[model samples]
Target: MRITKVKYKDALIQALLFIYLIFTVYPVFLMVITALKTNAEIIKHPLSMPIKLNFSGFIKIFTTQNFALYFRNSFFVTVLSILITVFVSILLSYALARYKMKYVNPLSIYFLAGMMIPIRLGVLYINELLNTLNLIDSLIGLILVYTAMTIPFSMFIFMGFIKMVPVELDESAYIDGCSERKILFRIIAPLIKPAVATVTIYNFVPIWNDVYFPLIFIHSPEKKTLLLAVTIFFGQFQTDWSLVFSALTVATIPVLTIYLVGSKYFIRGLTSGALKG
Candidate 1:
């Protein structure tokens, strides 16, 4: 009877998970179906299957919109943000983990405070800073903003992994005449790969998908990101539902592909980093 109850509970959990997956995928299914339908067909039955496959929306966006430029900007910014965040987080985590410094904990809290507050809250200040630096509508400006914004979370994840490493390793290396910098770069830096993967995946997605900052901060036609580029599919007089869906479909595929490729590494890293004890 107890075994039967356990089976039933497991079945219940599986059913719930399946339902959640469907709920998550329903929007994607809707978007794909709408993208395949004519705007009139979409209006008639918003949830119904497409009567005919539509390719004009796809053609219109690629031919008419600044899709290529937007794609380039987003790709450049996300990659650069990854580089900056990883470098800074790894170095900062190493110091906090190994060094005996006064105010180390408080200092970490100070770095982490940025995570709680939205950077948009300081738009006035950011605008002034950007204007003074003459960074308006520049991809470099976007990259810097995303890198600085993503650092807190990356630092936190790296710090968690670094804490799990034993100090004895560092001490042994020091005894062998390794300098402080040498020990940091060579001895204790490798065990945190999983945390690094987790941090990268976590930070990359939001940066890729962010639209508000790109819209407000960028005005130049050439500097649009993928999310902002999708806005071109919408018009004041007439919104092309099918084209909008198609643009979203185009924009979403790359991020989803990255997540799928990275999730395996990210989860493996998290489990190894946290459950090793």
Candidate 2:
């Protein structure tokens, strides 16, 4: 009787999960189908599959609408921001994890406190500072803002992983004449791959999809990121539903590819980091 009940419960859970998966994937499926239809076809057969695939909309976006430029700008900003955020966050989190100082707890709180504060709340001051530094309308300005915003959360992840690392390893390395830098990079860094992956995945999606900061900080057409470009494209082609869907599909591909490729690491990192923390 107990075995039967357990089997029934497992079946129920699987059924629910299958339903949820369909719900989650249906919209993305719809987007891709719509992207393949023409505007007339979309209006007449909104729920039906396209009679034939269309690449014209995708071509127009790349060739005529300058989505390639947006792609480049977004790629540059996301990559640079991740590199800077990860580098700084690892060092800061390592110190917070390994060291024993009176102020360490307070400092950790100070960094985590940033997560509680919204970036938008500081935009006025940030803009003013950037203006003073002559960084307005610049890719560097966007990268700086993204790095600052991402670091706090990334640091939290790193700290969790660092705490889970055995302190004995650090002591052993030190005994072998490994300097603090060597201990951090050569010793501790390798053990926290999951945390690093978690941090990268977590920060990448938000930075890649963000339109608000870019809208506020960037005015140059050539410097606009993919999301900003999509917003602008939508405004210009409000009546062209097919074109809009194509642009959105194009914009989504890179993010989906990144996530799919790193999904294993992403999941492993989160689970390990959470358990270790």
Per-candidate clash tally: 0, 0
Ten contiguous residues minimizing lDDT sum, candidate 1: 268-277
> Which lDDT values do the candidates have, in the order given?
0.82, 0.89
Give the clashing pairs for model 2: none
- True-structure lDDT of candidate 1: 0.82
Over 4 Å off, model 1: 1-17, 175-179, 235-238, 264-277
* Tens digit per residue, CA lDDT, model 2, 1-277: 9999999999999999999999999999999999899999998999899999987888888888889899999999999999999999999999898889998999988887787678888899999999999999998998999999988888888898899999999999899999999999998899998788788887898899999888888899998999999998889898888889999999899889878999886676556535643
- Model 1, 1-277: lDDT tens digits are 9999999999999999999999999999998898899989989999999877988777877888767777888889999989898998889888887778997988888987886788888878887888899997788888888988988777877887888888898889889999987887786667777777788777778899998788888998888888887775454214688888888898999888878899886565455434534
lDDT of 2: 0.89
